[model samples]
Target: MDRIKEKMNSLRVEADESAAKVEDLQKQVKTLEQENLQKEHEITSLTHKNSQLESEVETLEAKVKDLKTAADDGTGHLTQNEALQRRLQLLEEEAEEADKNLRETNDKLRQTDVKAGHFERKVQALEQDRDQWESKYEEMSKKYSTVQKELEDFQAEIGNI
Candidate 1:
């Protein structure tokens, strides 16, 4: 019947639309995954930098302590002691700068974590939607096949008559 053809055409259009949407969702998921991976790498690099800065600060502190001990032990000229004091001041400044950098890196790491979490959730939702659309497309195809078979059988009967 004409009505059956109309319904089949409509089903076909719906199926095609669902397929396109599924593909688009899949692409979005892929892009999000790539972004998430990039964020992870950035996090790792920042962590490494943070560790290095902490180590540097510790080393500088140890050097300052050693220089103080030397100055107090009276094992050098007065000029040598003055030079050591200046050097200590510069080392302390460097340590302070390193501490500041570490704090900034930690903040950046936290922000990256939040962004990664958001992208992961988005990817999961998109995947779920794609799965549902794929299931619908399969069901539509089966129904279309069944209807087409029925139509063929009816035509054969008509031809025989």
Candidate 2:
């Protein structure tokens, strides 16, 4: 009976531990969601910048095309056109690199979401296990009480004899 009580105590401790672990995991998931929000904000900013750069590049390209269509053989116009073309290329590359970075950031956010989901599942399972352990502990306590009462009744009868 002493061993049974000891085991019950140990199970109660385990249930407490499960509760603590669930709290910890919930905190981690909250932190991860916060971080993901920040990253999304950053992605939005980068996307806006990329769009602005693309518009500028498009305008520059149109101007260059118009100048070339005019067939101006002047060296200065040619030089200016060449410079504009080079600027457009550089802008396009910058936009491409920014897009690539945005893709990578999105991938990272998805992975974080997956991890958060996993943590949540773990917390749920732990909570259920804790509940089961508590139920078992309660059942054991009732049994122990019944057994103690029976033992007391037996002692009383012996004393009467």
Candidate 3:
């Protein structure tokens, strides 16, 4: 009976050790499962962030294309502005030339007016001299007629005596 009790006690101790080892292994398995769940959640978050970044890249590319088109339009506008400035400069020069021509014409007209005024004054003086000469000629003709009549009367007187 004593030997049987000793064998039963030893078997009970071995059984207890085996149960403790199984419990430790179960705890390690549960910790590994928690770590795997955390890793899966991190992978899901990184995938969402990557998708958002790709979408942002596409949007930035579209914005760059629009900016290029706007730049092209601005270049055309600048060219048109340059052409307008050239035309305006030409018009300004033409206007200046016309003004110079007008000034010269005005100067010539002033000279012609002065010459016409001088000629009119000379014509007035000539008309006055012509009237005086005509009056002197009429006086000389009347005196000649009076002298002829006196000569004829003297001849008749001589014949009567």
Candidate 4:
């Protein structure tokens, strides 16, 4: 009887530990989900900025093409040609910088995606663990209740003696 009581006590302790672990896992899952949401938002913002940069580059390229055509025609003054060249150089530099930024953003997005995937998998695993622990806790609770009832009946019989 004492051994049975000790077993019940141990099971109760194990159940409490399992409950704590489940709670901790739930918190971790929530945190990961929030981080995933933030990363998604960042990706959306970066994509929008990339599109704007692409449009600007296209417009600048068109202007450069027009300037090239004007320079081809001997009618433009030398000073005008020099000014156009300077403007084209500046535009090209800006376009190059924009492209570099876009590439960096894309890389960051990819890394974020990977991290999100990893977190999702981890959450799934933790959820599975929590479920298993819950099942174990239920089983232990049932056993504990049964053992407690048996102990009560045994004590009652002893008291009658």
Candidate 5:
């Protein structure tokens, strides 16, 4: 009876150790899950911002093209009005302003694309980092399980002894 009691006590100790290891692993898994969620949200927000900037660039390019067409029309040869020259000068200025706006928009679009790509790379890096953590967790979990099995075997042997 004393031997049986000692065996039971040993089994209890082994069980407690296994429980603690499982709890630690669970905490680590929870932390990794939260980090993954945050990275996904940031990538989504940046993608939406890049899409809006692309639309704005397209609109600005269309407006610039319209201005260029108006300036190139042969109104100087067809009209005898002295104001035709002034109208041409104003149109030229408007076209120049439109050109400036188009270039600025294009630059902004390029920058947004670059930033989006950078964010994408960041996300990939994070995923790789997470993958490494996951592999480590798996390995540790396996080791913990093996230790638990060993404890059970030792407890069984103690009972036989």
Candidate 6:
């Protein structure tokens, strides 16, 4: 009777430990799920931003083409000084546009760099979490096997009695 009570107490303790482990695993799963959702949101935002940048680049290309055509067409009709002044104005405008484009491109590049770094860190963190979970699972498996063997030995002893 005392041995049976001991076995019951042991099982109770194992059950409680298992329940706690299951709860902890559930929480880890929830955390990983939240991280996945955040990553999806980031990907969506980056995609939208990439599309906007592509549209802006197309618009800038059109503007450049239009300016070049206008400069070519206007050159033939002007006197030398007028032509020189017009050319200078067009050059100045082109330079300004180029500078503006360069600045915008640099800003976008910096933003992309920042996002990439953030993503890398998140990935590293996730990998660490996965490794920890795997290690815990291995430990749990070993513990379960040990408990099963002990239970079998107890059963055998009880049968002999």
Clashes of each: 0, 0, 0, 0, 0, 0
TM-score of 6: 0.42
Which residues of candidate 5, in runs, are more than 4 Å off?
A: 1-86, 159-161
True-vs-predicted CA distance for residue 110, candidate 2, Å = 1.6
Better of 2 and 4 by TM-score: 4
In the range 72-138, model 4's lDDT, one tens digit per residue, is 7745577678989999999999999999999999999999999999999999999999999999999
Off by over 4 Å in 4: 1-77
Worst 10 residues of 2 by lDDT: 67-76
Residue range 35-137, candidate 6, lDDT tens digits: 9999999999999999999999999999999988888766654566797899999999999999999999999999999999999999999999999999999
Q: By lDDT, is 4 or 5 better?
A: 4
Candidates in order have lDDT scores of 0.93, 0.93, 0.84, 0.93, 0.88, 0.93
Write the number of the candidate with greater TM-score, choosing between 1 and 6: 1
> Residues 125-145, candidate 2, lDDT per residue (tens digit)?
999999999999999989999
The candidate, 1 or 2, that scores higher on TM-score is 1
TM-score of each: 0.48, 0.41, 0.56, 0.48, 0.42, 0.42
In the range 59-121, model 1's lDDT, one tens digit per residue, is: 999999999998777666777889989999999999999999999999999999999999999
Which pairs, if any, clash in model 4?
none
Q: Is candidate 1 or candidate 5 better by TM-score?
A: 1
What is the alpha-carbon lDDT of model 3 when measured against the actual structure?
A: 0.84
C-alpha root-mean-square deviation, each candidate: 69.2, 65.1, 6.5, 68.6, 71.1, 70.5
Which sections of candidate 1 miss by over 4 Å? 1-76
User: Residues 1-161, candidate 5, lDDT per residue (tens digit)?
Assistant: 88888988888887888888889888888888888888888889888988888898889889888877665654554454557778889999999999999999999999999999999999999999999999999999999999999999999999999
